[model samples]
Target: MLLLKFFGANVDWTSSIHPSAKIEYPWNLKIGPLSSLGEKSWIYAMAPITIGEKTCIGKEAYLITGSHNISSNNFELITRPINIGDCCWLTTGVTILPGVEIGNYSVIAANSTVTKSVDSWSVMGGNPAKFIKKREIKNA
Candidate 1:
């Protein structure tokens, strides 16, 4: 994305970003090498969102980095970073809330909502995205 590059988003040319995907505040978005963003995916990067190398985000998935301050009377903004480490796969319709980190080589199932940090090499699923199992990688 030439526009993103111009605005200081560290997106590599090797990565694929769907034209329909919406990126807010591109300056805070960093997509590492070989990452692919699916159609209609949204990243609200009021704070930084770093997506590491070789990762894939599915269609309509949401990565949110901003929230309303619960303690504030006026509902002020609270921002936090989201980190998706290398070689991860986020299935379709997944929603990652603020301050969530998906560790390296993790896989998140379809339509899951991630509310907390996921461990490295994990396979997680369900509404609150429980850790299902550790990922097994074969060296062949």
Candidate 2:
């Protein structure tokens, strides 16, 4: 999709993104080699969203990198980067909040909401997602 790159997303030529995916502030987005953003996935990136090589973001997943200050009376906006390392998979309907780093080979299960950083090879699922187990890849 040369057209997609024109919109300011720094995606590798090998990467595949669905046409319906919404990437906000595309200049702040980067998807590495062979990574794919599935249909209707939304990346509301006011800051950077760096997706490492071979990552897969499943359908309807949301990666939000901006929020407003609740503690401040003025309610100023705040932005933070989201870093997803290589070979990670964020499954359908998963929501990753701002400032979260998902380590390499991690798997976020369907409908999970991640509020914190995930360790490498972790398998997490649930609201405010916690580590359920380690991801095991049996080279098939």
Candidate 3:
């Protein structure tokens, strides 16, 4: 954790990042308080990846912030930021692509590939993840 801070990662001290989690471009990553990045999660922070407070990124989840523009003659690399809002849950093996903004309290199911933004309180699943339902918390 000290090493990550030394590398300019803006992670809150209260956040829990597993030892095996792989983070590239640590300077571009920001994890808020009480967030937990599970073991073996890979964060490709080519641009910026922000995980809000109380969020949980499950084991083996992939947060990728870059892609190649195949149409370009040089096969140019395109980078975009990924934002996961507060109290969200990204389950195991989930892949969050570039430029995605997951709203507060949303839940991304295991093995889902999210290609676009998700609304607040949404429950998304499947490849190219679709909205399965809205998450309802009784006391929230």
Q: What TM-scores do the predictions have? A: 0.96, 0.96, 0.98
How does residue 71 of candidate 1 score in lDDT?
Answer: 93
Task: Please write out the lDDT profile of model 1 over residues 18-133, one tens digit for every residue.
Answer: 99999999999999999999999999999999999999999999999999988989999999999999999999999999999999999999999999999999999999999999
Report the CA-based lDDT of candidate 2 relative to the real structure.
0.95
For each of the candidates, give the backbone clash count: 0, 0, 0
Q: How well is each residue in 1-140 modelled by candidate 2, as lDDT tens digits?
A: 68768988899999999999988899899999999999999999899999999999999999999999999999999999999999999999999999999999999999999999999999999998999999898987
Report lDDT per candidate: 0.97, 0.95, 0.98
- After superposition, which runs of candidate 1 have C-alpha atoms over 4 Å from their true positions? none
Candidate 3: clashing residue pairs, number: 0
Taking all chains together, the TM-score of candidate 3 against the true structure is 0.98
- What tens-digit string does per-residue lDDT give for candidate 3 at 93-118? 99999999999999999999999999
- Name the weakest run of 10 consecutive residues (lDDT summed) in model 2: 1-10
